[model samples]
Target chain A: MNSFKQKWLICRTVADVTYKEWSAYRTHSMVSIIVGPVYFMVQYFIWTAVYGDHPSLGGIELPQMIRYFGATALIGYLTMDFADWNLSMLVRTGKFLTFHLRPIHHRSFALFQKIGHRSLGFLFEFLPCLLIFIFIFGVDMRPASLPWTILSVLLAFLMNFYVNYTIGLTSFWLVQSGGLRSAFMLVSGIFSGALIPLDFFPHWLQMSQFFLPFQYLAYLPAMVFTGHYSLGGFELSIGQAVGIQAIAVLVTFGFNELVRRLAMKQFTAVGA
Target chain B: MKRYLDVYKQGMYSALQSAAAYRMNFIVSSLITLAGNILFPLVTLLIYRAGTSFPGWSLYEVLLIQSVFTMSNGLSSLIFGGVLWTTMSHVREGSFEVILLKPLNPLFFIVATTFSIDSAGLFLGGVSLFIFSAMHVGAIPVLYWLQFAGMFIAGTAVLAGLTLMMAAISFKWVGNSRISELADSVLHIGKYPLPIFPKAVQAAATMIIPVGMVGFLPASALLGRMHASDYAAILPCFLFLAAGIWIYRHMIRLYEGVGG
Candidate 1:
């Protein structure tokens, strides 16, 4: 129990360092902030068009649909971080060795700092987009199912951290995973409902939302405000979302450990 | 002209080598893009399932527009995907200096530096689907005689303008890459038949960014939803290309160098 607590503290310390390293520059922070909301606006425009003609596209209604996009937009900002880990490409190019000599868990520091940068970006960028959404739609900030909604959003973000981090680790094996990264980002958008509500997905695709971690990212919690996931469904969905995410994190860490050992061996041999 | 051709050749070769080095990733990226580009029709497909035209376009008419936009997108990225990194790391790292020191025009050299050959798969996928859809809608027209030429001019101008818009960011910021993602998203929107947007937003697509001119306007001209006089869009198209080059030249002076 004591050792577990120690590791947990170490993780937070690492996350904090990363946040500072990336967010230290005001200009860099501001540019990301500006881009996030503008990007969000284009997506918001897409949904508004789809809903303009019909009250419901797929089981989701107009008011609920608007709120779903609004909530997902905010929640996704917290999870859609990928840049720090992309440093692996830089590592291959010899850009990452400078950080390696530092006295820290290089991977954790790199991953967390990028998350920190993205978080600052989101706060500056998304806060106004959220307000603009509220102003336009008069969304009920208080959904009757607030607790589960919050829990699910947090779970969605956590699941994404693992999924995103593990994918970054692939750079160790692949010459360039940025291409794979692009594919992964686009796929997550579908799940996270960055482009369209998962509910609107054809029946087969929507079912995969259950099997994959995508539901946890965008759908289950989104349904919380949409009023689809009732009290009973909310508990089950949150449990599944968190559970799937936990299992995914474990599997990913397991993969990372095996890969790390092998990578170190290969890296050492090259040095020798 | 010979100098430009040689630059394009060297650029294309390195881009090919990058793809060759990472064949698996390259293949997967192309496949993934093919899926997203193809799947984009889903929204419009659902909308049109209600059974109506956008004043003059049939459902396939929009698909035709998507094919043109997507095909050009596929071709441009395949031919010049490397320019993307040049605007980011190259300039940020002052590798632009290596490029500038060469006798070649650094602008053309950087822009053609990396061809995303994988985008070829995407281009072919779009073209095949486009041809299939076009055939389903109508037999081949001698209009094909003019199709390739028309698409080339429109596509080249849009690519230059959009690439410059993204490159222009390096004037002030390092790692201004989310804007590149913005370019990708905007390209996705351009594949829409007429516009999937409200009138105001549609107007923005046309007037503000002029992306509509690239794919939709020209495709619309071929489809007869737009008259040939709409070809007047060609003026603005070239103007955007010129303006982008001018801005980039100015931005080049402001580069403080990649301190990071």
Candidate 2:
């Protein structure tokens, strides 16, 4: 019970520190807030030209497609993490030793830090963009379905965290993890439907998504949030999506643990 | 000029050696870079697959524009990457003094010190895509190839000039390291034909930001779509370089250096 309390304290302390650090850069955050909307503007134009008086394409009409991408932008930004970049730098410089001397486990510390960082982004970036979509773009967000959407979003966040954390752990063995991160960025951008809906992809590409965890990261939760995938819809319900996301979180977390243990076995501090 | 040449020769040697030291990393990074280049084009492909296309421009024509943009980007990154990184670090770290201390012109010294070996991967990727797209659209005449070569070089200059101008903005606001992203976002519009956009955006892209000079105009020439006025698109390359140099100098005068 004492150990559990200690762990809770660590999580709180790390979260506070990370929140403070990001909050200090108010202007930087403000600048980043508009980038998503700008990206959506480009998408808006492209889709308008593509649709060209057609009511719907790929089962998503114009208004719904706008909502879909807007949700994606907000959700993608909230779940994004540069932990792999940070972790790789730390490992390369032998700064990972700093975490060893701390009372908390490195992975847990990172998780808490990420949570704190994203909380600020959610407040400053996500909410503002959400309001923009509703007022400016006329995207109808079904806030009536908030409870399930929030739960699914939380699960999606956890899944994304584990996926990124696993990628970060690769720096322990790889000479440079930047390549891995870049490669993952391309694959995940496609598979997560952050760029476009996976249904828009050819049948083969859509089928291949079943083997990847990218869908749980953005696509499923965004769909659920917009009420595009409800209980009565052709897609799975909120409960079923959450169950799959939970499983993904567990599998990825387990893989991360295994990789961490193996990486530490061969770890060497090059400069230290 | 001879001294500048020597500096670039040595820079190329060091870049090669640095690449050799991290050969595995380089190989992986190159492959990933290739993957990233291919991924954006895939977005266009998927868009077309949904029973729609960009008006008046076929899929291959669109691909050709994007491929030309990539190749131009690759060329600029290869040659002027030193200027880009120097502008970044020199402002952020207050290391501009080092360049000022050098015997050669600061611009020349900055341009001569980095080879950007990674751009070779992008160059090859761009070339491959260009070939594929060119085949689909049918080959142009020999005269068009001559114009294509000239336009390609001019387009590269425009890319370099724009990059330098964006980097120069770092001097006034060193804390905004992300200033380059504005340039990136602007250049991204060039991957599509210019006419699809609204008139206001079209005007901004042509006159203000001028990303059209980088790819759209050049690709239009290859497609035999250039107007007489389109030949003057290369003129921005010179103007951009002049403006970038002037701004860089102006910023140097204003700089107080780190922790001042």
Candidate 3:
């Protein structure tokens, strides 16, 4: 119990420092308020042009599409982090050596930093954008089941962090991982349903998404908020979907741990 | 003029030599850029495959527009994209004064030094996609091709203007990397049919901001759909470039170098 309390305190202090550091650049984060709505507006025009008096296309109404993107933008603020970039830079620049001297593990420190950064994002980035989506765009911001949606989004946050952390770990081996990282980002953006709904993809690709962890990062939570859970041609209840997400999070955590250990072995501060 | 051209050629050659040192990285980075450029066209394909599309636009026509946008974006990045990073880094590190001490114009020096070899992927991908889409769009007369060439150059000018403005803002807004994203979101307006937008947006895209010239107008010319009013957008494009250059120069004057 004492150990757990100590860990909690460490987490809190680190998070506090992170929040303050990022707050200095609040304008950087606030750019989302402008960007999110502009993106939604573009989507609004495209979907309106596509629908053209039709009630729905591919079983998704225009209103739901609007809500999905709004939720996407809002949740994105809550969840997004540059763990991969952060960790890779540390590895590449020989900064990871500093972490080795610290009492806490690097990943734990990174997580604590993320908590701090995202806590600021929650206030500065997410809330303002939520208000814009709700008031300006008139998007329905309520989830179908608030409890389940909260659980799903929390899981998504963890899932996204772990996946990116795993990708960052690859910097241990590859001298120049920017290309690989960019490729992964593109693949994840598509497979994670950040760009468009997975339902829009061909049946084969949608089915394959069921087996990948990418869907839990964005699509599942967004769909749950919209009050429907369908992927890979299978429709599951919100409860069941969240349950699957929980399992995926655990699996991803385990995979990330394995990669982290292997990566640490490859660490060598060549120039530094 | 000859000096500027020589400077640009030397800068590009140096960048190429640097990239050649990391041959594997360059290849992979270029391929990844190509893959990213192809993603939107794939999205367009899926939209059409779902049996719907933008009004009055066939799939290939839309693809042509997107490909043109990609090429413009690629060329702009290749030529001017480095200005943003160079400015941001120099300002942050207090090294910006070094550039001011140089004999050449600051903007020209920065633009010349920042030529990116990675964007070759985006340019190549755009060329390939354009050829494929244009093939499906049917043969274009030399007249349309000529119009496309002129409009495309104008489009590139608009993008260069936007790039300069963004780089200028970094002078004051130090460490604000998302400025490019703001530009990107606005520029995305150009990647689709202009008719799909509201009248206000269309006017802003044409007369005011003129992002439409970047992709929509160029592709429309290629497709033989240019109206006489579209030619009105050309002047605004140059005006916007002039405004950007003026703002950039003003910002450089305002830059009080950061203290240690």
List lDDT for all candidates, in order: 0.64, 0.78, 0.89
- The 10-residue segment with the lowest total lDDT in model 1 chain A: A230-239
* DockQ scores for all predicted structures: 0.29, 0.55, 0.80
Best candidate according to DockQ: 3
| Residue pairs that clash (backbone atoms under 3 angstroms), model 3 | none
Give the worst 10-residue stretch by lDDT in candidate 3 chain B: B251-260
Best by the lDDT measure: 3
RMSD of each: 4.5, 2.9, 1.5
Going through the candidates in the order shown, the clash numbers are: 2, 0, 0
Error of 1 at A62 (Å): 2.4
Better of 1 and 2 by TM-score: 2
Give the per-residue lDDT digits (tens) of candidate 3, residues B46-130. 7788888898999999999999999998898899989999999898887888999889999999999999998999989999999
Q: Candidate 3 on A113-159: residue-level lDDT in tens?
A: 99999998899889998888888878789889999989999999999
Q: After superposing candidate 1, which stretches have Cα over 4 Å from the reference?
A: A1-12, A25-53, A83-118, A136-144, A169-180, A230-272, B17-25, B45-58, B139-152, B185-188, B194-199, B227-229, B256-260
Q: Which of the two, 1 or 2, has more DockQ?
A: 2
Candidate 2 residue lDDT tens string, A161-202: 778877888988884688788888889988898888777877
Question: Model 2, B1-260: lDDT tens per residue?
Answer: 78778898998888999999989888887888787778768878987888788888889998999899989888888888667667778777877787777888777777777788988888888888999999998879887787888878777766777777777777765567556666676776777888877888776766666777677777888898887776765666567667767876676677666542
Clashing pairs in 2: none
Name the lDDT value of residue B159 in candidate 1. Answer: 73
Score candidate 2 by DockQ.
0.55
